[model samples]
Target chain A: MLLEKLQSAVGAGVILPDGHETFVLNLGPQHPATHGVLRVKLTMDGEYILRAEPVPGYIHRMQEKMGENRSWSKYLPNTSRIDYLSAMTYTHAYVLVVERAAGIEVPPRAEYLRVITSELNRISSHLVWFGAFLLDLGGFTPLLYAFDDREKILDLLESVTGSRLTYCYYRFGGLCNDVDAEFLTGAREFVAYMRPRLAMYRQLVTDNIILRKRLEGIGRIDAELCRKYGATGPVIRGAGVANDVRRVEPYSVYPLLDFKIPVYSECDCMARYLVRMDEMEQSLRIVEQAIAQLPEGPVMGKVPRVVKVPAGDYYHAVEAARGRFAIRIVSDGKEIPYRIKLRTPSFSNLSLFEEASRGMMLPDALALMGSLDLVIPDIDR
Target chain B: MTPTLDELNQAFLRLLTPAPALGTACEMHDATSCEGKGVSPNPAPTPPPTSAPVPPCRIVEGKTKGYHFDADLAPDQIVPAGRLLDERGFAIDAVTGVDWLAAGQMEIVYDFYHPVSVLHVVLRCRVPREGAEVPTLSEVFPGANWHERETHDFFGIRFTGHPDLSPFLLPEDADYHPLRKDFTGAA
Candidate 1:
């Protein structure tokens, strides 16, 4: 029944033209390898995949429709839910767009604080991806170590934002509250503690021969493919483009601090893995610099209680853990938005999967998906 | 090395003018390399062309608007604009639709971003609310396939040449356009 359904839905393309038999396989909606409720229909001939059609929307929440109905301030919390793994960065994009459209001025201290918290959030998010990705590759040991390190970040963020996972901490022009001295000291200590662990991770997993063999030449997404598919974050960086929102777009206090954008030209799974691993260290550097340059002022900026965005469209983008998360708002000079569009990176990243995974072994395709570091809700949003 | 944002801005400005001949336009583009090398640093001595085919879209300050360039184009001009952006190494960012029920019109907005130069351009086209249609950009930017589909699912704006117009982020059997302001969730 499943084969019949898939064959009819996907059409004659599923059956090979040269009289070889092909079977349809559903990867998820319940499978653990998928990370969330994403379903990819694979038309397979023996071990090789003929086609990979990702059928997303099992977790679709119509978040954009909800945005139009909610008032400006009332809709802020929804941003955190878009991509729960890197919730702070999603919130950063939302708040930045709103602040920019309304012409609100954030304090220098608040900008620094935003940078510190978001970078820490980025580190924590990457750690989750590290563990989850290794777990996908059948390595249980790294998952434990990655999560153990990730817990420290969650604890530090929880102390300040009061939420570990989906933090609704950022406001229109600034943050909801200030980071205390204890939080600062904790962040500094965490950065110092994380550096050695990253090296340890490199020694333990990155240098493993079996792991390298599995990922090195698998899923070769060249620079032109990335451009055609709009792949970014570590994916494009892995293809030798030094494209980073912090460096290119220059948001927050990033220009005031210093960090390197890791680029690896291999355009394979290993290259993406290396780029992300290097990015964690860079994020930590940013966190440390932001803490050291932490200015003194109120965390929240002054503005009218109800933010009435001017009658126009506004766009803002930030580098999330997965890639570039952008938000577009069409306001009618009212408290309620006319339309809201959340351009989640995972959506664009996953869109390229079908084209990239064509003609690959099933296991290799899964490895490529793991390298993408997708959060399904972000795609379905 | 990649061209600076200023060079890209100049390349974009040059492409906006109506090409006198296809061969001549290609030669002019070849003369001003997409990379920073070989392109003149100074502005053109001649005044801007007044007889451009499409309405002029100016590159603005990134501060006032969140993006660098904003172009309001007719529905037919999107493909040409997308082709020029693709040639200049800009990636398709997002395709969004805004329903203007009061104005009885719908707006389809396409965003493009240059990975190296960090320039962002937004192209917007307004169509009538009923039977709204625009040319597909998927041929130019394959990345636009899903975005265009998602926009269609939300606003029911047809991309005439899109390969697949099926539901994205919506149930396969869904018939309602939920993002439209008039949609009230009634079965």
Candidate 2:
């Protein structure tokens, strides 16, 4: 009866035989390794995780339901809160979908501006992931180094976007305001300064023998598995699929600017780490290119006071720092949406953990989760 | 090489020909014309009186590059159509539900994309609001397990063959489907 109750508690898939003894560990709805309020019910055979199930939604705010009730313009603020780490991309995708549905035209300069700031936000997000992942693996110094670099990007973004973290800058057709020349120069200097600093990161963390051993050959998720699980961003690229939404389904000014989609076929935690590391450089490149090609035009598009989407279903996807962030809006020719869904990247990326972490050591499982770079609120949203 | 929108439409048409007995309904059209015409060649049978008027299925062209194919399928056709896309190497990007309370129907949306060809397809299917159920795509695309569960959590739509239909992104004991139009958070 006790065994049956345990089986019922954490799904039958993780159940042990009648006589065998295995410990079921609850690893956080409030634990540091999880990075947020994410709980993992691990069925362990000694230190090896036989099955891992993640229980999310501690932060669920019903953002989608909130979207339906609020007017089209009123819902803009909620987008950033969906994924605070890459708030710009979330807000950008939300605006793009609404623009597509309402037939609003964004100015060329605004498109370029969106690209620059969004890419900078991507770099900052990757920096956070790097720091948090290393911190999870017991390296205290790299988190400090990663934050120092991230702070520079944040300062650059904050000058224009207003709020540093959960940005609500991107407007319906364009941006809330235009960026200044000082911001451009700071961004350019940061790019030049970051290239060598990345090389130093390779030397400090990437070359560290202990870090290498901890990541290499751990959490091997191949190309097919990634596709099967809808894993995106560095996780899919690390598995050798160059499936970045920026390249796959070109949006904003991504097609105009050129950058490589970093793919490391190793399919391990190290490969994901390297992909993020390489992607920060590529994001820097995109930002540099956008600033060079910056055009002079109005930042905000000439949008009508009352925003109404034609009765239809519209979808838009953007490449966020973690993966593909998509917004699907079902509009009913009114200011308020009939239904709204935010297809967040962290939700799908974290879904793969249960399958990927099975049969792995507990510490390696944490390493795998860290490499996936989940923001639990994003998953909950 | 990427298949043109016409070829993609034909592929879906083939999958739904002589539609199965689950009251399967579908409509096929040229992607560009669907945007302007606002009409389907053969609309689905009139929905039951209790259900709202069904919007004619549309196969509109995607505005963005690489987002080529868009179609509306009946509840039963989703799995077979999904299987064909899975075989063609389209990864399931997301599965979500739209609660059309006025129409008395729940629409399920699935987005898929080809890795190499970069062909994005949006498939939508609708069921009555009272007993919303659609065939699960989890078997066709294993990654859809969570997406379907989340859809279940928000809209209370059931994916017929889903392995695990437990609450996802919601507390286990929560009784309300928060995303439904009728849910006013009064509990």
Candidate 3:
């Protein structure tokens, strides 16, 4: 019966035609559409997916488990790995939760530094999302185009944080290094430099009707449905819900930066595209503001050589490029956290795919998955 | 002055803000304490040090003392933290289940954010170790279904009314809450 059900889902036959009835296909642990080591077992009826079941844990590093072993300070690195593309945002969530629990007041200058770097990280993330989203849609050119500008932001971040991908630059109190005046000036110049490029992105992708036909209404997540599933980032905003972690709960220098959280109410794939495209521009503006008012101060707070957060729970969320990133940390009066739980935005956002994809074509489903903009590690974690 | 989450919390307490069950969380403290992410409050009056220590309770029957957070909702409590979080403008980020073997018991943590409030609220409900169960919030927040499913998958806890309780990020019959202290199982 199980085999028959699987076969029917595959749609070849409830009974075998040539000994074997089902067209079982594994859309793999490495397939581009699988989004990084995700294996979705698809029992198919020709090109149509009859049954699609997701398989996770291929790269399950057990970050939450690792938090139990490492102290609060030692576990920050783990955040970067969950959604490596949005590492800084993950670490920001980690540090902020500690700050809230322990009452560590991050100074004004520190907040500006955080904003400059985080916004740059946001730009870097969106650039990748933009490129990758397009790449998924079958146009490979935009990937490289998005990366060119992303390199600039990456270089700027590398100057301060020292590493590109899994940066452990943020301390509970401040940054690991100060923002040099030259770096500050360069960051300011870069944002000013990238202004028109964003408009170009709109023309190249956002305004393209062909792209719209592929995305526009392909994955229509209604406003009520979005909230029901706890979607965030552009997915929720696209549904006409004005909910952004940065705007709703202002953190760092965001309250001072004077940038609007872009929200589009269309609740479709195209709406998500527009929301993300507009957000990158808003991120640039925030980065510019931070560099303009870049106050002079020590980048690292007066933290002891070995950082130790006191006992009790600390939960903090950051507006990652994708959505709200909530980190719940419990320290056992040690350097590491007794327990650390990451509430990744991508995981929840991706769930909408199940509802949004029902009764949709395979291409439409892919479009819906792409539009959700989730990184699997974030989901698996 | 732009208000922060800390200021909001203080105002909530002063105005007798009903201890609703959810709020937003942030990674960085914005401008000042007022704008940081959601933080569970300590019962003590004074703010604790960054490295403040909590003594681990002696292992009583292989478990620590479980604390109950029964924050009674006032009858006219207009903003029941849980309902408002899903009804109007809030976006649920992630739901967390905190299992404290050292302190004992488990805390079901819900993080919520309203774009305009500029406030993040964290609501945590507690359940004991032997039979941990909570009402499914999936009926309220569709996103909670995934979170609740993942929590059920990893922690091996049951959400009594969860519509679908299959393993989301785990193998169908895998038996291990990898996040639990005694977990060694995997898919």
Candidate 4:
């Protein structure tokens, strides 16, 4: 009898016993580390997972339909809600789309400010991922240690932007407010303080032999599949595709600022982890450049208060911390958009995990998942 | 990246070959009080309205690009164009269906994001209050399966042939779609 263990419905009882000598196992939708509310039915033989089926849609919020009723400027705030961790980066992409749709021009100062906040948000997202990744692997202390620096970053962000977790800072044409002098000085201090501390994150767990054994070759995706699945950010970079939207499709103040995208040939867990860590460093460099070259000008663009973009279609994507976050707006020559859609990276990138998780042991599979850096709220929304 | 208003004004003027109906296009400088209802800052050619019935299309206005007719698609046109777009390397970003209860109509928009050209196409199809069904895009973009289901969950539009059209965001066996205008909040 091949019995299947129902992942979330423990009360409904496990599926018939695999009586296959091996056994079927129930993972979790409730278990703290399934990312968020995801239940998976795994057919296992002894310790190796034979077939791992991911049953998603547990958190599907019809995000697109809501955009239809709202006006273009109103849609900007929704971006931050989708990905709470990378709030600034998410809105950065969204504001660009709205600006393009409405034909608004942001000043040079606004662009630099956008870059600075966006990069800061990237680093912040990576830090949380780093801590959560280690925690998933069963380490507790690093979670606290990582948060120490993260708290400082969040405090800095909150001071200027107003919110900590879900920030809606970027305005349509430009930012909501110009960065004050004290805010800039504090940002510089935070960067200087965190630079050397990152070395500890590198040396402590990333370089450990046991961690390497778990991450090095567990879940391997070839370069070809990466492109096919439209994987972006560190995941695609792990597969050696040097397609960073900042470079390919320059938006905001990215063209004026200088930064490097790190890509590794190894399409495995270590490669992704290393890529994320290096990206944090690159983001720091962007912060420095923007701060040094911070220009003086208005923060908001000359966008109409009630933006009625002439009936047209406009698409814009920004390289967020996770991947390319895109917005597509179709206006019907009305106050509201005929249609609005968000192209999120997590949904596409995380879809690859089901294919990648087969054959690996349960622990190795968890490690591979940690490397993917999924923010399920974003996925669900 | 968006073309500046100035650049758009130029492009729109060029697109207007003969000239606008009002001799010149107007810009709704104060849109907050009024709809940017005026022609535009950029003068463009406005095709004279013909006796032909305006079926499923919207008026297209662009700052730089000339104003033209944008097809507000019918179900028949939507299915094929969706496949063509998916085949042409545009990834499905979202499948949205909006219900205008007061207006007695529902609009379904399939938002497609193409990476190569970095262009987004919003293909819209509307269904009457009686029968709202759009041929499935699930076969074309596998990612659309959940989206269509979600649309069904909200707007009450049936996406026939959707492999698993269960209530995704809502509870199991819930008769009403919470997103529908008629629905009275979370029941």
Candidate 5:
């Protein structure tokens, strides 16, 4: 049926020298360039793609269904599972909606701690993206460097959160636990250590002509396209729109901290690449400032014993590693939520691939996909 | 030129203002009736019977509420709302359904965020649970294609005029909608 729609839109095919027409090529569900089990059914006319339809849902966990079944507090652990790459931010978004609905006041110290940990997580997420993305583009060394830096962040986070990957660190009103002085000192040292590494990464990967040729002027997505598809975070930032949720929507203690939303108007893969690279530096800055201005107070907020959110709907979004990760909760003034929608950014970001990758070379299209910094579990959720 | 939250709020009000005679009666009609009623059966249009003010279809500014501007719109009003918000440079965030099973109604919620400003606009419309359907916003906001399909997958809500409503995040051949309150996992 997708083929019929494509055929109706762009004829049956372009006759090749070999007398064959455009044929369908299933790209993933298990391919390295995809980064996960994301399949793209590409109707290829030789090396160029006529259309690229991403077949998602290879890992649908019914995350939203679980939200309805479980009690409000019981669903906290599931938030991290939606997007493992940036579990803290995803958890923060879920925690926020419930807090707002229940009228729970998170303490100032907890807010600052949330900001510090989230920014550190963002840097780690970006580092993984930086490495995996470079690896996707055929540069393996950066992944090693990227994970090395990322490992330090994981260690710091693990000291507080306990788990390394799918972190259920954030609680209803505040965080699961308070960050001690040792964790704070480790974060500060990690930030200082990461600054020069970013410069080195720019020298090693961004300066390379091969990566430049692979990314520059390839898979160019403008601001209008982003708005149409609701593509957020670095994708929109790379398109020159400073739509960062932290800056635009003053959630957490972000309004108190000063940071620049790295926007590049070039709207190419390179622009998206450069945006993520610069964002890590900016995350380091926020982590640095947040630590220095860290308040002396309690991390956990006062709350009722049995959590029952009021009968109303609430929406809260946080700047996750991929984009603006949002959560919409419909409560029935009961312990269990009526409905919960986890709006993962990659879901929206990946939706744009079909339209954006039209008529582009397969390699360039994959480069564009890598630039999207997709976590397939997030999209599949 | 990023419009401030106030500007966007005012713009939404101006767009949603009742068009004199063409008031809220249009809310009850389904998509087929709304589309077919382009050529009204009655040649001479009669003035709306009720002088009682149109309910708050306008955007409600609420800092306490999760969204800055929350409006309960009629099912038919979603497309125009989408167009107005789209023109105002608001990006389509997410579209999902809420099942008020006890009320025998299903509510479709559309969340929109301004790319340049600090505003989250939520548009919600309720329809009867049996044979639930709403006009597609995929034409207005292409990003809504997957969202609408996912909503359909979970709640069995049909998005009329959706290019392809093939099951998203569900098996293509799957016949069950799992997220409905009464859905039993018997199969």
Candidate 6:
């Protein structure tokens, strides 16, 4: 019955082949491997996947409609909730769009602070991805190590943001609150501590023969496939396209700061893993530079009590941990946006799973999904 | 050397215009002009006290630097324009729908970004509110498939020729589009 439904939904010509006995496997709106409420309907022929379709939307919250219903400033909390793992990036993107549309100038100090917090948040998100990806590969120890580092970062962020996971710290012109000396020192110290730990991680996991055997050259996605599927972040970088939004479309203090985008041409699970590992180090460098060049000014900029965007459409894209996090706002000279569209990278990135997993073994397909680093809520939102 | 923004703009104008020889007369209204009139082609029924005079329709600089190209294409012209952009190496970044309730229209916004040249083009088209329909760009850039589906799920704008316009970020059995301006869900 499920196969018949899938056939009618996806079309008989595309999913099923002639004379091939295949059974459909529902991978879950609840399975542990998916990491969230995401279900992948897999057409399997004895342990090999003939076709895969990801069924998202278990956590759809109508975030865009919420944006229209609420006031301009009231929508900040929803941004973070979309992708809790890298909440800062989402908040930053939302704030930046509103700022640009309203012509609110952020102080240089605020810009630096935003970059520092956002990069730190990137590191925390990558740590979670690292932990979860390894757990998917059956290595339980790495999750502990990854979380150990993630908790410290979260603590540092919580000191200012007031919440650990779904942070709503960024305001339109600046942050909700200012960061103090302790946060800066803790960030710098974390950078120093994390640099060596990355090497330890390399020694412990990246170099392990069994891990390499599992990940290397499995689930290859070349550049063309990435372009077709609109895959971004590590998935595209692993395919040798250095397409980081911070670099391609530089925003805030990223252009002023110096860092390298890690790109690998192998286009496999291992390549994606290495790209993310390298990205965490790059994010560390950004955090270090932002701390070193910290500016002094009022963190919050002057703005009207009631924010009204000039009647126009605006687009702003920021590099979130997962990929290009873009916000499109259409305003009609009102406090509430007429329309709000969140161009989440995870949605585009996760769409590639169907094309990427075809003809691969079930375990290898799961590995590929892990390397994609999906945060399901983001996709559904 | 890559083409300059002006050259790209001119090329886009040439491609989108029904006839290149018609020139400036055939140019669509600038996005700012449409904005001044409250995102409608027609003037607002009752202008607000502070409403500024509408500007002429022409290509103008966007607020964000490097985002130089902004235009409103007719619904019929979007597919050809999208194909031109795809040929020029601009990837589809996002596709979204907007509800212009007062104007009684639904708008589709397509954002395309050129990786190397650092150019961002925003293409917008509007359809009637009751039954919105727009051409699908999934063939030009396959990434648009999911985006179109999401837009459909939100606004109920049907994408002609899309292989699968199934529910994306909504429950499969959802009967009503939630993002339309009129949808006042279980309040």
True contacts kept of each: 0.67, 0.48, 0.46, 0.10, 0.66, 0.49
Q: Given the true complex, what DockQ would model 6 score?
A: 0.51
**What are the C-alpha RMSDs, in order, of all predicted structures?**
7.8, 4.7, 8.9, 8.2, 6.7, 4.4
Candidate 3 per-residue C-alpha lDDT over A295-353 given as tens digits, one digit per residue, 9 for 90 to 100: 87776666656766666555566789888787766665666566677878877787766
lDDT of 5 at B103: 52
lDDT of 2 at B135: 85
- On DockQ, the stronger of 3 and 4 is 3
Model 3 achieves a DockQ score of 0.24
Chain B alone, TM-score, model 6: 0.79
Candidate 6 residue B169 Cα shift, in angstroms, is 1.8
**Model 6 over residues A294-325: C-alpha lDDT tens digits?**
88889999978999988877888889999888
Q: Which scores higher on lDDT, 5 or 6?
A: 5
Assess every candidate by TM-score: 0.90, 0.91, 0.79, 0.76, 0.91, 0.91
Q: Which candidate is the best by lDDT?
A: 1
Model 5 off-target regions past 4 Å?
A1-20, B1-54
- lDDT (10s digit) by residue, model 1, range A40-81: 999988778888999999999989988988899989899999
Error of 4 at A119 (Å): 0.7
Backbone steric clashes in candidate 1, count = 0
Off by over 4 Å in 1: A1-15, B1-55
Predicted candidate 3 versus true structure: per-residue lDDT over B51-125, tens digit per residue: 522211111110111111112122222134456445445556567776654334455666665544544455555
TM-score of the B chain in each candidate versus the native B chain: 0.74, 0.77, 0.57, 0.64, 0.76, 0.79
Structure candidate 6, residue pairs in collision: B30-B57
TM-score of chain A of each: 0.96, 0.95, 0.91, 0.93, 0.95, 0.95
User: Cα deviation of A95 in candidate 1 (Å)?
Assistant: 0.9
Q: Write the per-residue lDDT of candidate 5 for residues A253-322, one digit (tens) a residue.
A: 9999989999999999999999999999988999999999999988888989999877767788889989
DockQ for all models: 0.32, 0.42, 0.24, 0.12, 0.36, 0.51
lDDT of 1 by residue, B6-125 (tens): 665566556555544333333322332211222234424323334443334556678957887766655666888799788888899999998766555677889888888778988777
Candidate 1 lDDT (Cα, whole model)? 0.85
Docking quality tier of model 2: acceptable
Q: How close is candidate 6 to the true structure, as a TM-score?
A: 0.91
